[model samples]
Target: MKKVIVLISTYNGENFIREQMDSILMQQDVEIEIHVSDDNSRDNTVNIIKSEYSDKISNLNINKIGTGAAAKNFLQQLMRLSESDTFDYVALSDQDDIWNPRKMIAAVEALEKSNSKMYASNLTIWNNSDNSTQLFKKDFPQKKYDYLFEGGSAGCTYVLTRDIVLELQQIIKNIDYSEWPNFSHDWLLYFLVRNLNEKVFIDGNPYINYRIHDQNVHGHMNTLSVKMIKERTKLFFNGWYHHHALHYKKLLQSNSLEYKILDNFTKSYFSRMGVLLKYNFQLMRDNKKFLMFFFFTMINFKTPKDV
Candidate 1:
């Protein structure tokens, strides 16, 4: 049996943690070892895992000294796993999602069949309030610069080969965490993997139920609501995207085309015109999002804020 290490980051997830744990433990055709990092929950999340799952999970490792940020917690565990070589694959999990019985095995099979180092899949988004479910498709044909704008999928559905994990470990080591912007870990990972020229396979089929609730750190934004528009506008005008763009430029080869385009884009609005003219439609998944990217890049002239 192939060994898989599952890393889960938790934050006050007492309500559904048990269900999530049970689903993970029930995975088929893989030897599972779970590593959980809890962000100092004030609830019984830590207690529940220890009392109920310790015996059930033979190799369970729970660390409760998290910095309260989900990204930091996940990255910290990944950094630690860099020193170990005990698993064939590494998967990221959320504290609230339920996995199918074949999630891990399916990921393993897909990776082997496609000869890909990294994998991400679409998911079924289950809304807690209305009890409605929708298939969130992220299997669009990847464009040239999609990683610069968004992640392929949620991190919960991500599965990485051991080689990819080690590559990420090296990249993580060179990063100055204090200077790093608050980018989603999954997005950053996707960016790094793509920048390394690694082949990533995005599975159209979903193997997990992504539960949406009030306490979710980041939820679905498929529907364009007034609230979503306002939030996106705030992030745009406040220089969040610009900051990420500028920071990411430093991590790329200076002479590469990606670096040049990103460098030009980070300059004044006039400098960005060339990039917009040449790669406008190529930067996003679809023309609709490309229009939004164009509008934001055209109107935003404020200097990127210091991190």
Candidate 2:
């Protein structure tokens, strides 16, 4: 049996933590050891894990990051795991999502079959309010610069080989967290893997139940919804996107063609439009999203500035 280490970052997730943990424990055909980091949950999340799952988990740390920084919580786990060599694969987990019994095994098999270092899969979105379920497709063909704009999928569905995890550990060590903007860990992982020219396999099948609720930090089922569009527009205009692009460029420290293209796109509004025209703005795999990206670039008036 292959050993897998699962890292879970929790906030105030008392309502669904049991269900999620149960699903993880039920994963088949892989040896499982869980590591959990809590961000000062005011609820019974920590208590439940300790009283119920103490024997099942490998380690648990109650890091009181009162600011609810999920990305930091996850990254800290990666840094800790860098010291160990017991696991063949590392997977990220959210406190609220339920994994399928075959999630880990399927990911491991896919990675081995495709000879890829990183893996991400589509998910089933479960809306708590309506009690509805929908398949969220993220298996679109990989675009040339998709990682520059969006993550391949949610972080919960990501599985990484041990070598990839070690590489990410080194990258994290070099990153200055104080200056690091609030970027999602999933997107950063995808960017690093693709930017470094590592092979990644995106599975078309859904293997996790992604719950959407009132307390969701970043959950959206409809990409074309007005709410999502407005949120994306706000981020684009507020220099969030530009700031990330520039920061990633600095981290790469490369004169490669891809980085150069990203640099040109971040230079100015006109240069961004030029890049969009050059590629027909196909940075996004979905056609509608590409159109939206074009619209956001066209109306972005603020010049790129160091944040």
lDDT of each model, Cα atoms only?
0.83, 0.85
Q: Among all windows of ten consecutive residues in candidate 1, which has the lowest summed lDDT?
A: 57-66
Clashing pairs in 2: none
TM-score of each: 0.93, 0.95
Residue-wise lDDT of candidate 2 within 230-277, one digit each (tens)? 776677777767777877787765777667777888887788888888
Q: How accurate is candidate 1 locally (lDDT)?
A: 0.83
Cα lDDT tens digits, model 1, 174-218, are 876556666678788888998888878999999998998888766
Deviation of model 2 at 236, angstroms? 2.1
On lDDT, the leading prediction is: 2
